[model samples]
Target: MNPWEVASPCTQRCVTRPTGNEQAYARTRRVPAASVLRRYASLTAALGSALAAGTRIADPSVLQRHARCVLGALGIGLDATGPLRVPGTAAGTLIVANHVSWLDVIAVLAVEPVPLIAKQEVSGWPVVGPLTRRTGNRFINRDAPRELPRFVGELAAHLRDGGSVMVFPQATTWCTAPGGPFRRAMFEAALRAAAPVRPAAIDYARDGTRSTAAAYVGGDSLAASLLRVAGTDGLAVRVRPCRTLWPHGHDRRSLAAAAHAAVSDAVSAPVLAPRTGVFRTARPPEATVPPQLRAHA
Candidate 1:
């Protein structure tokens, strides 16, 4: 029960204006031929180890540990400032992080083992796709907005069962230096399930300077990003754990704002844009509060 941790529930609010920055792009300088060769060999071996662990192991924790080792082998280092424990009540824990690049997923997974909420298309990616499913992730269809309610219901149920779910509230990827506003729809699920939102900030650096070599943004192909990342020297991913927030008395919008603020502050990124008062989906009647949280609500 740390006083600083902030956690989650859902809201029905949507963004009318686009709140993401399109100008930011991944930039990487050329490295020495020897450096690239060493990293390429390391990355190849890491990928093989990850695939073997994922296919051979059935335990989630074991698979995640192997995944973490793979990230280390690929030169992504973990720099959690404090104990990485996520705090919460009997209700489930919702772990939220800023979405910078595809590497953010691997970085978080390396730090903690939890089920992830990802887009349906990730399930079809070559080697990574099947591994994601085997690791116990839930996939949502980005094409069908109407099915969001169903997905929300499932998320709430997972929380009620005292499980932890990891999500990227930004809803899309941004450059390593910039981040988008947190979408509030997913907050409503936390509201219903009475889950705590754990905000985590992830950043990539090369030789101690912030680097965009890992950003997989606008029109950046997977192969291109991979090549740049593997060739970069002194590249590392840092995961900073922030305080957790609860959704007991607050509505979905306030909760989303709190979580977003925690992450924005942690990463030292400016608040890009506002997404308030935009009506997207009609809100359903307030869900019946559980007895444990009724007093706080």
Candidate 2:
């Protein structure tokens, strides 16, 4: 059996599609067709402008500004809590989040722009591919299990060199909260580098209620998802950064469990069952304080 076969799996079965009535409701909230077109145009212009500037504006703040502009063009707003960038640490921090939509990458960038771990296919994508490469993001080939150890080692080296990286531990997109289990392989990088792990919870909402308009799940094409996001009004992404976890005296499995619990609690989502036998111990006692208590404290 392939070693990577033991990794947690997330398939099309885990995706939750909106019902017919929910689809109708989304349509009602959609902007005019022309508005969507304009939004796309604006997004293109923003990407083009950023590309034209080259590495001169490669600063994280500049990248963050560019991301915000892209979101604004799509009529989406961003609300983030906690420190987007951990301060005073020379060691790179591993930023982990639950995956929901393609927009998640941009949403996270808007708050804190950093190179991310993406699937290898993203490197071949039209504009996004070139942009990601230009910005120093790394990609992994999910089909090539043999290459995973090498990739994880390189990722650890990067972190040890003080280069931060963001990754979606869910490994794939889900339609809503309480998504798939957090894969443990990526956490191994954090453990190897002795880097701190920062867990963030991401979700979409509109009119103060959870919204699935931005979800990009099974069978959802990129073009269709983009159009859906552009057409939706009052769409906003919420990023809540949880307490940072240190690797001292903890194994990768415990670290993954603790991070998963932190993100799940932050989004008010129930914790999903872990893959059988993958987690030998319960979530570590160092798990983050519940968001509600943290808020009052």
Candidate 3:
């Protein structure tokens, strides 16, 4: 494993007092200690237990918590809440959401207690990819369609074994509400795997009409986006309830359409406020490695 380097580009020293913008930053500001410590602890233990644990790594919730803490320490925070709650369990499931920023993964994983499905390229990036793989994440090579089947098959077994997967249906990070058409690939994977699809809406807001939400979008890099928000006084994230969709035994195309509609409808809600303080449900399964998730059928 490579040494973990600082990935987020936040530069703001945690401000004690707020001047409008900083208030929003404070609202989301929460330290990234325990999550980070917990993960390292798990890694040390994993080294001793890797052989017994097989090729897959050990518990990664700590890494996710560490990530959230790191982002929080850097003045980045996410508040995800909804009247309609999505139950999280170790039970096999699939999650789909709109892509807002690369931070979307961090914010979601910080609060969401499950592994993720990211793009193939992320697995080869600098520090981020290493961290991603350490957490037992998988990806689809948009360029290599042939390998997708094997990946989908692996995801299927994961669902069958009661694991959960999260996917960004938008495929690319864009800032507009009702963004581009939801890609059909992962939707099909979930259908074939018989995993439920959960749609989450992610948004950014700043003081007044200053528009902090738009900073993370466009062709900007994730590091650049984080630095921009941290340097600013007030930037906030409001995540909507992830809309969970049952396959309904539908075809891939039909399921894709339904999934897209579900996500699109959820994003239609008025802008939401940020959620805080380790939002969690009780007894979320702490899946470390493949376990029974690597099924063949």
Q: RMSD per prediction, one decimal?
A: 11.5, 8.9, 10.1
lDDT of 3 by residue, 1-297 (tens): 111111232222222222345434233332256644554455345333433333343265455556556555544445565322234433466776676566677666665656788777888886566666767788766666667668778887787667777777666655444455576666666666555666666666554221334335444666555445445434555556544566655777777677667667766555444333445323322333233323344
lDDT of 3: 0.55
Per-residue lDDT over 38-150 for candidate 2, one digit per residue giving the tens place of the 0 to 100 score: 99999999888778768744678788778788888887777665444455455587999988899999988887789999989999998788778877789988889889899
Clashing pairs in 3: 21-233, 21-234, 22-233, 32-69, 35-66, 36-66, 79-275, 91-162, 92-162, 92-163
On lDDT, the stronger of 1 and 3 is 1
Model 3 is weakest, by summed lDDT over 10 consecutive residues, at 1-10
CA deviation > 4 Å runs, candidate 1: 1-29, 54-58, 81-85, 269-297
lDDT of each: 0.66, 0.74, 0.55
Score candidate 2 by lDDT. Answer: 0.74
Ranking by TM-score: 2, 1, 3
Relative to the unseen true structure, what is the C-alpha lDDT of residue 157 in candidate 3, on a scale of 0 to 100?
Answer: 79
TM-score of each model, in listed order: 0.77, 0.82, 0.67
User: What TM-score does structure 1 among the candidates reach?
Assistant: 0.77
Best-performing candidate as measured by TM-score: 2
Per-residue lDDT of model 1, residues 80-170, tens digit only: 4422334325676788888777888877776677789998999999877877888889998877777888999999999877777889877
